[model samples]
Target: MTDFPEIAAANPAFFVERVLSVHHWTDRLFSFTMTRPASFRFRSGEFVMIGLPSEPGGPRPVMRAYSIASPHFAEELEFFSIKVPDGPLTSRLQRIQPGDPILMGRKPTGTLVLDALTPGKRLFLFSTGTGLAPFLSVARDPDAYERYEKVVVVHGVRQVSELAYRDLWTREIFEDELVGEQARRQLVYYPTVTREPFERQGRIPDLMASGKMFADLGLPATGFDPAVDRAMMCGSMAMIKDVAKALEGYGLTEGSNADPGDYVLERAFVG
Candidate 1:
């Protein structure tokens, strides 16, 4: 995607960032980090448009909304993406290497941020596949740890290899100088691979319904207590809807940036 000479040469409305590194997690999933603009400011769990020039000497560009996987406080911006075989962007995007260019949108926005929900004792971040990207950002943000007593992150994937950023959550974050110890103590990661053999192997919705996820975590016997738990969900619209309906059943209400409440969600993809 960055091979285009014209795209790399221009930087008017958008920012062209240099790719720092790229790691292929699986044939279908990968993650990349790029230099961040000093002037760019965004909340931890927000997303921005990113893509390549449309074509040779074309005026328009190929773009898609991508969640910023790195925490806002970090110097670099990271993104987790799926390599759809026929996706207009990912088809070519999957070939990107370090030192290439990436076009980033000017404005970053989303409803999955911590600000969209009210204060609470526990924070639950539920996601699936690449949907886990935003929660990765939220997990690294020092504010998330400071705001809530416990931060529970659940990531569901088809295979164990798809559980991205495993080391960051298990090792690096805790060893970090700024929020390491606090993050280690406050963050609880529960990763599930639905199609693979693992200690935990069920979709989050099923885990919630069966009270098995809560039991594993030693949560209250009745499950969610909206009075103390606030949550954020990201994934396919179907997954989000199912999780949203479940949260509502637990006495939680949907919230937004304008009106903070018990829970909030964002569509992983449009219908």
Candidate 2:
């Protein structure tokens, strides 16, 4: 007998799977890996609806869309999440342990995908906080490396401790057999801390507007060029709006799955 008969009855689109592992990144952030159904399929940089069973005899399940953090080719699905003490989902989700049951929707979709952007020489992925999740999936895909000459990841966080996957980008990924060689020559990571002191500092828009980010990277000081630059922005609405406006000023156009353009944007899951 399943523990979530209500969920199953409420929607046949959802799959019930067991938690394979969980890692608490910080008091406010965590990530977990879950069993993936053989039939489940999704592209890198996409999101899927996931949730927990509703309280006994109350109502339907409480679900939220979360960006898939792991590459699509992986055997299991991985998700990075923010922990909100009062959030309906995270309050209980933060306590999940190995072997716990989780609900995952069958259909995964989003606009922050490679198919939505036109071909370019440089690919930039900008993210903040848990927004880094989707870009994680995007950065790891072999297709991304093959399509673009350079892959730059710009991660902004309030505190240095919030910078997750530091090892994966700085060291571990470079050691992997598949993409390591390409990553060594093409991957660039720029992590900025706003509230705390760090080697690099400031919000992403501020960094780009001042030409400091490009200067630091030894790239053109004039900033993003639509002709050779394809970009994706995922984070807070404020950051996306600001960055989008700035990109537009530099002649970049937003794109979608239906119409490939110079750039794309998506809102990070807010819990």
Candidate 3:
């Protein structure tokens, strides 16, 4: 791994880590793995601020809050990202390669962690596009299966190719030794596409409101039961508002790290 001793020494608020590998899933999306500092710690479903080091004699480095895609227990940290053609950070972030230096904040925090939700029979992770990042961490966590009887990951994207980490849910997680057994018995992957031909189609809110999601899962077609269901959501601003309203309509209250509730959303990660 490449080291950026200068950047680490220059900034006390963030750590300079080296990129271990990168996978470009599509022209618009990519995922990367990086060295995890022994000192850096965070719960699954949390997000941390990360950025690229500025050029010599340039302005301050650009930073953005990104959900940690790898589980909390993983030796290395992984992140899923979108390639924004002219985005302030993603424009440059998308071109990163293995051995490159990246900056990660010392502190990691978000409302999507399991601690923010009350005990329930099922946990529904709703996400769109790159918002699926944190759920990757949450579903891989063993505590999730223990706290809830089932862990449902519902990902909605524009194209089938944009369904990042599809294999992880479809097969890799089941093959994992630590959470595989639990995942096999309790995990459910419900992926849908908006502008493509797929087995499942429609926005998440529509599916939830129409009870299609429930029927497909073999659950009661009435809708989310606040007493038995817990949820976390991450997505575009429009998607967030829509889904939040839908959840609220079902009597599920929004939650945060301070107050546990029936549901939670990572507002900071919304585009």
Largest TM-score belongs to which candidate? 3
For residues 1-271, what per-residue lDDT tens digits would candidate 2 score against the true structure? Answer: 4565655676576898889999998999999999989988888999999998765587878889899998889888999999999999999999999888898888899998999999999999999999999999999988899999999999999999999999999998898787888899999999999999999999999998899988998889888888999999998887888899999999999999999999999987542
Count steric clashes of candidate 3: 0
Worst 10 residues of 1 by lDDT: 1-10
Q: Order of candidates by lDDT, top first?
A: 3, 2, 1
| Candidates ranked, most accurate by TM-score first | 3, 2, 1
Estimated TM-score per prediction?
A: 0.95, 0.96, 0.97
Q: Candidate 1, residues 30-128: lDDT per residue as tens digits?
A: 999999989999999999999875556567778899999988998999999999999989998898899988899999999989889899999999988
With candidate 3 superimposed using the best TM-score fit, by how many Å does residue 227's alpha carbon deviate from the native? 1.1
Q: Which stretch of 10 consecutive residues in model 2 shows the poorest summed lDDT?
A: 1-10
Candidate 1 to truth, TM: 0.95
**Which has the greatest lDDT?**
3
Better of 1 and 3 by TM-score: 3
Off by over 4 Å in 2: 1-11, 269-271
